[model samples]
Target: MRSVIDIVDLSTEELDDLIKVARDIIANPDKYAHVCDRKKLATLFFEPSTRTRLSFEAAMYELGGHVISVPDAGSSSASKGESVSDTARVVSCYADIIAMRHPKEGAAFVAASKATVPVINAGDGGHCHPTQTLADLLTIELEKNRLGNLTVGFCGDLKFGRTVHSLINALSRYEGNKFVLISPEELKLPSYVKKDAIKSKGIPYEQTTNLEEAMPKLDILYMTRVQRERFFNEEDYLRLKDSYILTPEKLRKAKPDLAILHPLPRVNEISVAVDDDPRACYFKQVENGKYMRMALILKLLKEAGTL
Candidate 1:
């Protein structure tokens, strides 16, 4: 009954093994195409999504598995006030595994606690998004040739960005990895994240309001949207939304091989002109996410003795 509720739930060794599996899937697609034939994946998305939901469905379909999904509460029994645990208990009977995205924190944990099958936390409010971190790790490994000893810069909404929090927590376990956090003062990385992930692990990090000044020193730059949904005040959101737009001119100071990543649905944070630049690997990241999800499905099913 191993479940991935957080990125750190899987150790560095486990992540490396999954990355190896993902690479094998990428290289030998035909051999592993039908590994999960007749298996079913249940996607219980209590929130709106485009990439995460589609990637999970795509992953299952690619592995020859069927998907039964509740894309949102409007179309599910949740509209009748059904509980997450009850939903999990029922869906477990139908699907080999479950991937959930919810608007409330720890909702996936609640589902996994009662489900008969393995559960993956897709995106739980502002809590964590482990699968996205997995995709990020794979992309970094492919582009940089190694995960450790790189200066990674994270820019934009650090406060509400679950992807930022999860990736930092995952990367902190590696050797010689430091972070340069670039964000507006209001959206700086939370103190709890600073204490647990960076400080407790002895991972060095510097905070900055300037993206350009941090560019040349970074081996990787991860950009994020300043989410309008996370803000209580519309005026504050308007003031900060365009704070760190990454443009071609600003990238002139970066290293030639610096990998630029965005857990995207880019709302003008990254310029369209930057897409032509070799450093922008966000689109490649989307494809890598599907392969990583496929690897994860195989791993979890094997652990559950369902495959």
Candidate 2:
């Protein structure tokens, strides 16, 4: 009945509750093993993904739920011209919940409008990715001990980074959160996101091209790759891809406890040498993603009275 199309769809209180559930799941995995004993999760990914797709599947399996998936658009009826709404209607009969990703923005919205089951937007084009924001929130909370009263620096492809956009929207709701937007002028945070999510809420933010200048003040440093898929021209992708590579040298100016996060399948924006740093929490972000997703699944299923 209720579908999560954007990060703002869930209130701050709901976000906190989800984070609490995720932490409990982390502490006691066995307690939730059979929560979805006979439930089915349908993963309908029209776009290519590694982390989001596998994380959703892993979350379902860990909850004792079965998975029915369409791993790619080529193998799905969408390739044969079936609309996303029709696909959702069909999949609704087969699964208790749906996790969908599509290259087209608002594809999940279309699916949610038709599906009888609750729909979770896994990722939709360069638009919203609320689940990734959930993972990011859990990561920040665990690392920083609090989400508010901290400076969060978002680096790399901000314009096309759905994760970045979603996190800004979520964090702006919390008190005393300042945003440091670091990206090339061409890839700066969209004006609409700036106006609607940040400015309208009277949240303070700074725009910069220098990552090093923004480093020292940050409590959380989120790195995002310049997506090749989002770029229409290959030359633009190649030119901007290597813009901000986070190396040990870059972290020299950063805080000792700065939580480094990436909604990854990282394309070398982060140097491998930095992986051993105590501050590096991107892999932790990946693990947290599964837990947050598990929590979300439980909540949505319970809301739909499917659990």
Candidate 3:
């Protein structure tokens, strides 16, 4: 079986296939329902989450499968100092597949190395969130009708936005796509990500501090909260917390068809007023997340001979 530990682990063709499956499911839900009948999905979340965790659980339910969850590390064997690998090995005995979220970087990778069944990385610290990228791709495809030849702007906490990192890696493989990285200097996209996902790919990209300047040219405007959880210094987080807020007045300069996305739990970075705007696709992004996850679970289980 295969494990989805990073976006880079999936090729563009594979992503396209998943998106196609998600689209088909969206089009005819009844036909696709019960594809994973009688299967069990184990959600091993070592950290607290809402959207990602719930989306995975909802996806399994829609497929007529059962969910077995370790909602938090405090309630799991990990509280007794059980290792991730051991937990993965043990859980594989009870479930057909595993979707995991952890606060430590590479924790999913460690689990995937030991798990007998497919291990899907729900999220892993500031490192990566591959499944979120799947949702993002499906959203973009549904909205824009294509993945390539668009300018996308990423604003706010690029330094530790694992969703931003994963999405950029996935999109860079497509043709004619450019990136505008917008954030305060302290929260700029990490240098390693720039080197590996952007520069090494020879994809054109610009770095800027002005969100307004970038908005007018973007087909997609991706906003992220300056994650307080990733910062060691509370003072630093407070200082940069409100660097970029998307107000309606600010969005007036944006393209009428701009797709606004946020991997959310927005803490004042995006005004609630912006939700009424047709351009706001974050909520739509949430629904797409469930369908994409359903697509992933179906693929993994079928490959594992469990479906």
- Model 2 residue pairs with clashes: none
Question: Which residue pairs of candidate 3 clash?
Answer: none
**Candidate 1 — which residues are off by over 4 angstroms?**
71-73, 228-243
Model 1 over residues 36-147: C-alpha lDDT tens digits?
A: 9999999988989999999999999999899998647536798788899999899999999999998889999999999999999999988889999999999999999899
lDDT of 2: 0.92
Q: What are the per-residue Cα lDDT tens digits for candidate 2 across 39-91?
A: 99999988788889999999999999999986476475987899898999999
**Which residue pairs in candidate 1 have backbone atoms (N, alpha carbon, C) closer than 3 angstroms, thus clashing?**
none
Ordered from best to worst lDDT, the candidate numbers read 1, 2, 3
Instruction: Please estimate how well model 3 matches the true structure, expressed as its whole-model Cα lDDT.
Output: 0.90
Worst 10 residues of 3 by lDDT: 69-78
lDDT of 2 at 15: 99
Indicate the residue-level lDDT of 50 in model 3.
85
Query: Where in model 3 is the C-alpha error above 4 Å?
Result: 227-243
Alpha carbon deviation, residue 114, candidate 2 (Å): 0.8
TM-score per model over all chains: 0.95, 0.94, 0.95
